[model samples]
Target: MASTIISKDKFQFTDTIREHLAFGIVLTCLFLFLTSAYTKIEEHDRFMNGLLKVAFISHYAWLISWTVPVAEIVVSLFLIIPKTHKWGLYGFIGLMMVFTIYIGSMLLWSEKLPCHCNLLIEKLSWGEHVVFNLAFVGLAAFALWLIKNNQYKSLIKQNDKY
Candidate 1:
């Protein structure tokens, strides 16, 4: 007995957009996992200086405790699976946008000689931080642009010629 394949025309190019965005988002977040671990060992002073930056915020510790590592881990897995990749990209974009804002805030407030926020933070000065985040924002914006122009979204706008 032989098995036959059937095509139902379920959804067009949904997988492509998901793959592109997922690829970008996951590779981007990989920087986080590497940076977090790298700074702790390779450079201590910069790391300490960064923590000093956030030390005054009462909730900072808890935020770090739960948000950073967990987000890094969860998103990594979520993005790896094809079924979850689309939604995962959505979540990743949202989180990264929010992070860009935080980076912007740090740059704006640097006049007070505010701490850099961590050792990895030392890798980029205030000006550098803003530039880095803007670059990330640009990446996400491009992904959105691609998604909007994608076959799935645009194909839906066309008339069936059959």
Candidate 2:
């Protein structure tokens, strides 16, 4: 019998699987943001109300509630193109982290947690929302790592051709 060893960086993903996973991560984020943007825009006042419960002040909450949807739309657009995908992923990760913190805080500190207005996430309990956001964070991180490694591999190949 022969024993084989796999490298840690591979994470058991073949090149094709890695590629698919990367695309899936990007697309999933894009879909999530696009749909969320639409819902937020459609239910703008409700979103503001939800934020008001979470935020310390109403005006600041209003501002955030408005800006968040626009940001989501922009991030979704940027994520589709290869040139902007890295930055999009970075933004996605940051946003997810912020959401995770916000949800976690709501669960811990807030006496009355605000209901979310987004489609799927809106319905989830705070703990479930945290888990969902954390999952996205992991996906974004993995996508980033995969993209960087692919670039590194390409660069090495180019050097070898010299």
Candidate 3:
């Protein structure tokens, strides 16, 4: 009878799995941003009016009404291209963080909850909206970590060869 020892480096399934998971997360975020942007564009008047109802940003409603959708579209484009995917994830995380903070502020300080979100997101309550945005932010951040970790590991392996 022969005994075989398995070394850690001999198995790379974890790396492959992590890469796939990161890709899946990026794709999900891309879909979400693109859909949200499309909805805002399609219902521009309604979204702008909703933005106007929020007291803090009501003054800048005109600017934000256009900027939000445009930002979302641009971020989605970044996610679509492989070269810019990492930056897209960072953009996604930043946008989601801002959105989550906005929702939290609305919940804490505002008398009325005003949501200028897309169709599906519009259905969520203020608290649920906060949770939802935070969840995306977390997922995007995690995907970014995984990507960076994988890159670091690859660099280490390349260095070891020399």
Candidate 4:
């Protein structure tokens, strides 16, 4: 019985470590996006406008360019706050999905790919962009899994009380 309890505690400790790792991954991603948005706002805006014009979506290009950075900042804030973390993860996933789709589409159909994020990110090849986005998506998915698992475990414990 004592060993069983010790094993249980060890399991919980491991789970906690995983949870913290997920949180750290998410926080790092948040900072990455925020810094990318901040450092290249003008270039990003210009690139978006140019790409949209080329894609024939000129009407909304300006709006999207201006809004994307603000959205990223807001999402970063959400990820930093525990009460808002899940929502932040959702936002992060959505943004990454959109970015991935855009990069994928450009790679698939466009003659030339346009990058407007940051200097470091702009250097990534189109394929690398997809890989990078996918990695963040994986992180977000893992965080979501941890959150759901903890919630489920808590629910089970609550039910066991009766």
How well is each residue in 24-130 modelled by candidate 1, as lDDT tens digits?
A: 75566546544654544455455445545663443464455446546645665665675565555566667667666766665565444444333556667666766
Greater lDDT among 2 and 4 belongs to 2
RMSD of 1: 9.6
TM-score of 2: 0.88
Return the clash pairs for model 4, or none.
none
Residue 46, candidate 2: alpha-carbon lDDT: 86
Model 4 agreement with the true structure over 11-130: per-residue lDDT tens digits? 563557767877887788788877877865757756675658547445788777778788888899998898888889999999889888877877777875555666657778879889
List ranges where model 4 is wrong by over 4 Å.
1-13, 42-45, 48-53
TM-score of 1: 0.56
Write the residue-wise lDDT of candidate 2 on 1-162 in tens digits. Answer: 123344555456666776788888999999988888999889888888888776454669877987889888888878988799989999999887877887777788788877755796777877878888898899899999988887787799899999
The lowest-lDDT stretch of 10 consecutive residues in candidate 2 is 1-10
Question: What does candidate 3's lDDT look like per residue over 105-127, in tens digits?
Answer: 88889887756777767888888
How close to the true structure is residue 103 of candidate 1, measured as C-alpha lDDT?
Answer: 62
Q: How do all models score by TM-score?
A: 0.56, 0.88, 0.89, 0.82
lDDT of 2: 0.82
